[model samples]
Target: EDSIVPAAMYEPLVKAFGDAKNQVSLFKDIVLKLPRDNRATLLLMIDFIILVATNQGNQMDMSGMVTALSSCLLRPPRHLQERISAASNVFAIIMFFATNRGTFFAPEVSSLTQFLPPDDPALHQPYSNDKAEQPQQTQQTLQTLQTQQTQQPQQPQQSQPK
Candidate 1:
């Protein structure tokens, strides 16, 4: 309920507790100091703010929420940086689309990158289906490994001498 419920509630109460104005003091003061697993839960709370503020037509300024998220992603214990960056990317896309319904895209665009952050370089690049899944190296490597596994001939197992 943290995400979905708060997503609904923040529409009316943003003036009081909006992260933009509060600068997400609660998250900085309490959540960031918590352990990794705990931070995950609290990070999600901000996502609720993003999703709600956008989808609810609440017209709230998201700068504080964005700043809080960037800190969460860019702060230390660098181990979690990648995961945080990824989650923040998801949060950015959701917020962008929810706020701007269609300046350059509609659901019919069917291209996921159309919803990327305003500053993403990929936004300037031309999109094509071939470039959609560019991280093919890993999948190709896995396929090669599977083919090798299937093609190799197996030798009869030798019983160990007692």
Candidate 2:
């Protein structure tokens, strides 16, 4: 039961990861925004997909895995017309995540932060499409700082008296 994603979160998740060029960053954002249990469940699901696709590449590639899991993963748009129009986009989003799992799920950066309280000043307001770059930018800045620290010149230590 812990592995099951709640049906209620499906719609909002789809909307949060709405179509755009930078789906991997959006994928990372959605994963981090999830409640603790849900976040664990989703990460497990993605790992499973990657495992299956990798082990059975001849039998099931990323697109094939996405097709197999689409019903389980995606919540269709409510209106009939909307569902018809949105099906491909829904698949595309999932496909993009699957194909670029390395970028979105990089081991060094993939850990989810503990959930923040609703009123926590640090929690970002719900992300908008335009603000999708924020997470990626933050990540880049972190990497740059880490690189600078590692590459900083070590000052020569004066000889210590015995």
Candidate 3:
């Protein structure tokens, strides 16, 4: 439990996707460098997400899970411009990882390369509900959130008890 997932762990992979000709290999190289426990923790979380998404596909598919979980699992770098620039790549990597399921990391097993996103980093965009099963419902929920945030008055803070 590190509260902040290290940007060092993610940014290199993001850069690798953009710069490396063999992005999968470069991604594996970056990942295998992590400490054994860190690697296990990362993979285990991804696996759990995969399992939940698989059983709940009607409600939340793999792409949805990746969209929701990536921010919780990896923190991007500190620079404002770089952070904005890297966001799509970060989403791409998470999508790639969830789709491939760490297949590149295991030499013994055959890689399941299905559902792989495009290698071109420029094509990666933040997940939109247009891709979701219920786009209208999701849009309504999002609109409701925006409306509440704008229309609701802030609660007054109470003094702390002695």
Candidate 4:
């Protein structure tokens, strides 16, 4: 069944997904029909996400990375979302290496970043509380200095006694 499924069924789905005209709707259908335990489903999801991310500004709309991330998050079952999130991290690391080598790993890093949530502490660390508050603290100090300057009365020079 596995052999037949990939060769016969999955190939057609992949081909349909590759088509620009109806790829999004077709991918949705394929996702709905995919067997829950099938690894191909995961692969197909990744491929479709990459396709949409890369094709933005051409046949597809790139918009931002958040759209792709949101689509994956909206998929049924928390397990699948977690799997895709892990896959995204792996892809990010791989692409970073590829980019440093002056090679293109994929054309969708920006979109991927957009899809990732800010609260994902594993993705990006938050500033320390003290560090985060430093800007506001500095602004307040500047305001205090300005107020002190305004409140101080300038002393009048005494008239010279003849």
The estimated TM-scores of all candidates read: 0.22, 0.48, 0.55, 0.23
On residues 73-92, what C-alpha lDDT tens digit does candidate 3 reach at each position?
Answer: 66666663375343575567
Whole-model alpha-carbon lDDT for candidate 3: 0.62
The TM-score of predicted model 4 comes to 0.23
Residue 156 displacement (Å), model 2: 66
Which regions of candidate 4 fall more than 4 Å away from where they truly are? Answer: 1-5, 39-162
TM-score quality measure for candidate 1: 0.22
lDDT head-to-head 2 vs 3, winner? 3
- Across 61-122, the per-residue lDDT of candidate 2 in tens digits comes to 77777777765665544553263233575566567667776665655533332344557554
For candidate 3, report its TM-score.
0.55
- Candidate 3: C-alpha RMSD to true structure equals 19.4
Which of the two candidates, 1 or 4, achieves a greater lDDT against the reference?
A: 1
Error of 3 at 40 (Å): 1.0
Instruction: Pick the lDDT winner.
Output: 3
Q: 1-162 in candidate 1: lDDT tens per residue?
A: 122212232233223233556534432333224444333443344445556556656655465455445443333233433543435543553344234434323435424343445786766877555774666966898999999999999989999999
